[model samples]
Target: MPLDEDLLPEARKSYRYQWYVVAICMLAYVFSFVDRQILSLMIEPIKRDLHLSDTQFSLLNGLAFSLLYSVMGLPIAILADKRSRPLIISIGVAFWSLATAASGLAKNFVHLFLARIGVGVGEAALSPAAYSMFSDMFPKSKLGRAYGIYSLGSFIGGAAAFIIGGYVINLLKSVDAVTLPLLGEVRAWQLTFLIVGLPGIVLALLVFFTVRDPRRRGLRRDADGGVQKVALRHVIGFLWRHRRTFAAHYLGFSLYALVLLGMMAWTPAFYIRAFSLTSSEAGYLLGVVVLVANGSGVLFGGWLVDRLARRGHTDAAMRAGVIGALGMTVPVVAFTQVGQLWLSLALLAVAMFFASFPMPASTAAMQVLSPNQMRAQVSAIFLLISNLIGLALGTTLVALVTDRVFGDPKMVGSSLSIVYGLASVLTVLLLWRGCRHFRRSVAAERAVGEPAAQPEGVS
Candidate 1:
């Protein structure tokens, strides 16, 4: 039976209230990335202190976090699907923030690696729940913009990590050590971690008090009006049934993530090593570029897709993603090869702009294809694949190429070029292929009525 209009939960909330939820979610996302990406700015100092190789630092930056993050995401997502999403998000925010602060206290590589893993576990709970909530809060037609706004956390958090981290490091450079009450004097890198991690606890509290769990939509409810639990296998089957769409979506995004994560992790080091710029200089320059250029690209992509969808382009989101992937390829490759710092930064600005363009469109596409009951789990799976491939391999790939293939750590720029250049080619190809399948999926949903495509309340 078609769902009655009165049975849907979204009718009760004002659009303004819904957008406020998005803003709060965006803030949570900002904190998550700030904790995650702050380590990127301090990589050189941390590496020097720990006497680590590029490979080891890559493990801290990528694999340590990705391993636990990707693994824990599904179960946490299952919890979010069934339980209170806001509570889960608040707890996650607090846990990760504490863990990030703990990273500053590490005495050795093993200690710091474990701290990174804790950060991963805490962060795992955020996005799946956030995506699911946004899906319920916004109408399908406007999801592109909603997700675009939420994804701004990535750019904002990332830019803030660099800008704040750079200045903090600069301020502490003159002071040899920072002394806390219990802990003895700590190095600047350690203090940086401590400073960045503490504020998120307050943000977590705000989310807990301010954000409410909006009722789930598009699910079967019992006679008493409670949502029924969905079985895991049924969710898998739905994905299997639409395997082509997911395969292309997952692969395309993962490849794009490979380029995105690789650039984000390495670009700071590139400017530092390649141009002899201070961390502060690289941070400020790249931060401004990411803030303005990448931020604009994300919003523009979302607006473009929403406009196209309104004009009767059912596959507008994925089509927008394809354009972003294509536009990013040349500049990413050119940015690495350019010798002059100014030319390189300019190229990097262009690359950041185009690189961010596909994310909102891709994210919104996933929400559209998923049934409400399976949205969070599906998002978890998407994150698992993308992070495993992107975060795990993105930094490591460049490190391996530089350490072994190029045999020079200073050649990080060339390594970034080689990895992203190849990844961009693959990204364009995968998104292009995915577009046709995505359109077919949308058509099928509209034709059969999406709810009838799968059995309901299959716990």
Candidate 2:
């Protein structure tokens, strides 16, 4: 997957625009998470206003969003493979941004739930297109770094949701409520959603204008050297032919995501309940950790893997993922078990750091293993599986354990421990298996041919 081999003439000559594309895509990813994750910080107010239990709120946060996000990603991704990826991304960004604003206007649980669904559908269009574009823009060697940089949006957006949301909520708490001209009085939570959602419209326009779709790489061409349209069945057949590699990849990452998303959805509540911190306090503290620790982890992991790959380690990305999974387990378990706030936060920070590693690696693997024509579809399938398992179950499982098993809402920390600890163990096992299959897959591809062509002066 080295860039020298896969990059087109235009891309090989102009490296600056590639970085610009990554930056813009990263911003789109940032806005996606900001709109999606702001809900976690607003949990208390939302629960109170809607008269919801932990289980009910979990449904709104997890299932309502994940269902549409997972189901719709495939078709949208297919469109991305065939059409203008930037344009598709622009439409998605605008749709999700509007949906996020609409969330502020919801008077009831159902309305808010529907808005979240829209947000899910919109956000689904992003990563597949982004991943495909990155594959075409960068050489295989830099895929890890490119994806890692793009993935920073998750932490940045999550942090912004909390830090910004926390400050806004704190500022507005003293006042009863703010009255909008036509909207009448609005709660602090509603205003928080509105403030975060509107700016993304401008971001969408920026994406439309700024990001260019690169020529597709690593595609199967006809006798005339024209790229063929990859059929859906062809994509399915490719996956089936390499089922073990994909199975391990998908299952392993889904397990990792189960732990990651579970922590994200409930850590604020865990902080509130365990340390008696206010929502804003919890948001700000965790926000800082996510921005710093997760951001650092992603960059470090991507750089490490790229360096390893350059040194002739074809399985470097999978190795990094395995190490990350193992490293994350102890800190996450300890974070849940610890009673001291400082100790717990420290543990949580370490856990987030390691948790960030596997994602860029996973993304790199997807690009390396698939043809360019099939890359978007493969990515969509990955997201669909990961989100369905991770987003759909991550929060709900913790809530179920708290409400049903512990029979107490305050035992959320224990529930997180139970869920994440088990998931981490499973993740380690699956990733190890995946590493073996991934290496074999890489060898198989290399044996078939040297990459399309190694461009001079690209690296």
Highest lDDT model number: 2
For model 1, how does the per-residue alpha-carbon lDDT over 358-431 read when each residue is reduced to its tens digit? 77887788888777888899889988999999999888999999999999989998999899999999988988
Taking every candidate in turn, the Cα RMSD to the unseen true structure, in Å, is 4.5, 3.0
Candidate 1 Cα lDDT to native: 0.86
Which consecutive 10 residues in model 1 have the weakest lDDT in total?
450-459
Q: For candidate 2, lDDT tens digit of each residue in 1-459?
A: 455545576665588788888999899998998898899888888999989999989988899899999999999999998999999999999999999999999888999999999999999999999999888877777888899999998889888888988898888888657899999988889888899999999999999897778887777777798877788898898798789999999999898988888888899999998899898898899999999999999898888789888888777888888889999999988897888999999999999999988779888888887877788899999999999889889989999999999999889999998889999999999989888888888787777653332123255
What's the CA error at residue 381 for candidate 2, in Å?
Answer: 0.3
lDDT of each: 0.86, 0.88
TM-scores for all candidates: the values are: 0.93, 0.95
Which residue segments of model 1 deviate by more than 4 Å? 1-13, 220-228, 451-459
Clashes of each: 0, 5
For model 2, name the residue pairs that clash. Answer: 1-140, 2-140, 2-141, 3-139, 3-140
CA lDDT, candidate 2, residue 294: 90
